[model samples]
Target: MPKQTNVRCPNCGIQFAAPVETVIDVSQNPNGKMLLLAGSLNAFQCPNCGSPVRVTTPFLFHDGSKELLMVYVPPELNLPKPEREKAIGDLMRELTAILPQGSFKSYMFQPREALTLQGMVDTILQADGVTPEMMQQQRDRLSVLESLLGAPEETRPSIIEQNDAKIDTQFMQTLSLLIQRMAAEGQTEVAQQLAIVQEDVLAFSSFGQTLMRDAQEQEAVMQEVAESIQALGAQPVRADFLSLAQRYAGDDQRLEALVGLIRPAFDYAFFQDLTAAIGKAPADEREKLETLRDRLLELTQAVDAQTQAVIADAAKLLQVFASAPDEQALDGLIRENVAVLDEAFLSVLLANLQQAESQGKSDLVAKLTDIYERVLGVLREQMPPVLRFVNELLGAPTPEEQQKMLDENAKAFGESLLTTIDAVSEAMSARGEDSIIERLAELRAAAEQALA
Candidate 1:
């Protein structure tokens, strides 16, 4: 026996076998008000077009899980009786040349002249000016002709011809072929859709790469401008970085790169003013330089807040790290990265504690412990594993070794924060934060090492 065909497009009249998945909605109650699926059939699709298909498996009379296999008909594809009749009429017209006048006489159940009358009716119905109202009147007349055609033996000699039957069957076959052509057309559509998607992605990637390059160029410009302004003994204002920053403000990736590039300038600005003060000068000259330095310090105080404002978006800021040259834009990047990590670390710690308290589970503290361990693990992975272990151990039993790591990590965030404050302070001849100033070297070293 031949394999059975399982699926067909009612629209196109194409048929083929297919493995398909089907959701079986099962009703738990006999009232048919509530439904639950006994089980779903899986892995079913059209072999030709890959279109998803479903088969409604009927529930067995006895066993609930044992369903009866049944043929599926898509409800929307069913043609109404009137439409089917019209389709048959249209097919008959296609076979008009092959049907003899004697054949039509038998079909119409009247004199041979009736065949010509039916042809005139069909011609008027097919005309462009014939409206639905006119077609309805014509169909009423067609009903009479249909009745005559049904009585083939009575209508044989005068109203119908033998050739009519053969022509009609051939026309029905042509209609079936038309439906099959439609099904074949559906198979090629998915490829056209995929091509459109590929084109869109290529365009987006090209745009992204262009924007990234523009950001790098702007970052270089910002660095140059910052250095120039600091060298002139002037403060770089918001306007100084605006042109390049504005170019990328709307772009998340480019804006991040801009921030990383400017950070070093801020650090260098601090160093320049502090070192400038050691020059020998008369009392008034020294005082004037000190005053100018103080103003520069005030300007530096706004840098962090301003930088944060420029890179306010979290999605945009993440892109900066990727764009940073060799992962070291400046010493300050390390401090900034650490501060971000510290803030995130603290938030996670607090959340874990809250959850532990709510659940009354002391073991929940393991999450916090894991995070702390990861911080150390990241250091080990970044550096050497032995060095990481050494640093961890140094923080405990060996006080001397412990202080070194403390001082090192402390310098960038702890000391660097102080240096930034002092640079601004001394540039204006203002009071310095003494502890930070003394530890500046260690802080700078830590920042440099972290970034390196």
Candidate 2:
């Protein structure tokens, strides 16, 4: 829980009441932990002028799992020595009062002190496995990014060329994360600027070019492998997968794509059959088959490992959401982690929902359903207007309903709706979603007629 504190906005010179978080317990209040890490805890936008205001006060940080306890008091407050000691004592008492009996430890009595907010944040991140060196490197990358963004458009290419060595994979990932965070925080202009900077980096940096090429090639390989699997008919057996593996034996990318697309097909029986085939092959061909088997096994293991990592991360995020105390807290969590509320997280949430339904947990089901709807609402709001309109049209069950939606939005969408429909139809055709492609074709005709 946050303490309501009166704060004066520096820009507006108006005072307002704001919720100021004083205690951040990771296990009990993960939202506070997240906001603190994001550097937004106790930060508020002035109601009158929307200027950012930060409240600095003494606070206690505790992570029971890590056995870490610390307290921070801003030196700018300039309280007397006795008063500072009294404030710290008061915060410590507050922390202990909320904690369960018998959970108190020696460390709680002698809490570590953090002189600065950054120092506290660094300590928290270090506890989570991020080393000081990694933090410094991230800071350096951010510095480079800022320099690039601040450079004139005509000079950006030169700046990128100079910093090309620094703009590696991790730098690109950092930039991407910043873009997503900015967008999630509703800093549209900043996000758009960062996006332009990303494009500039991609255009001028050598590593970026290689990454783009690899992504394009991987997509092409996946599409080709998808077509091959589709050609195997509705029911592809172990033998069919084995044949596909053999066909893509020398091409590592294709083999990886094939295994990724049909991972469940490469079970024990499939491997055993491959081993048997390897044993029966001619002496000269046996080595090749054995190598193919080894490669398939490696690909399957890698795919499984990657999938498990994704699911584990999603599950952890879901736990954070479940631990949120109320709707407002959950909403804050959703906004903070919107970048990671991807398909994997949604799948995990849906699985939990189903399990709760099967167990007849009506309260949990309702809560989870509300979370699902809220997440979808936020995602829909983030979509481009044209895309959102198309999605709404698709959700309509019947032609009449779809037509009614189209009619209502036809003037708003204008000619762009038909163009968007054509684009979606092409994408659906490439993915071999025949039914969706057909429906998109119908939507396009109706849209064109309406717009005409």
Query: Each candidate: what lDDT?
Result: 0.38, 0.84
- Provide the RMSD of all predictions against the true structure, rounded to 1 decimal: 30.2, 4.2
Root-mean-square deviation of candidate 2: 4.2
Clashing pairs in 2: none
TM-score of candidate 1 relative to the true fold: 0.18
TM-score of each: 0.18, 0.81
Model 2 / residue 172 / CA error / Å: 0.6
Which is the leading candidate under TM-score?
A: 2
| Candidate 2 per-residue lDDT over residues 299-399, each given as its tens digit | 99999999999999898888767766766556555766777889899999999999999999999999889899988977886676898899888889898
> What tens digits encode model 1's per-residue C-alpha lDDT throughout 1-452?
01122567444445555323221212221211111111112212343444534443311111123221111222344657686445444433423333345443333221111123234233323442556775665454334334433443434333323323322322333323322222222322433333332233223334324445676687565555444445444455544543344334345444444444454544564445444543655665666555544544444555566655544433233333323333113111221233243333444445555776788776545544444454444334333233343335334555465456655654344444435534533433222244534444443444445435
Runs in model 1 lying further than 4 Å from the true structure:
1-346, 354-360, 383-399, 403-452
The reply for model 2, stretches above 4 Å from the true place, is 1-57, 62-69, 75-83, 90-109, 123-136, 151-155, 404-437, 448-452
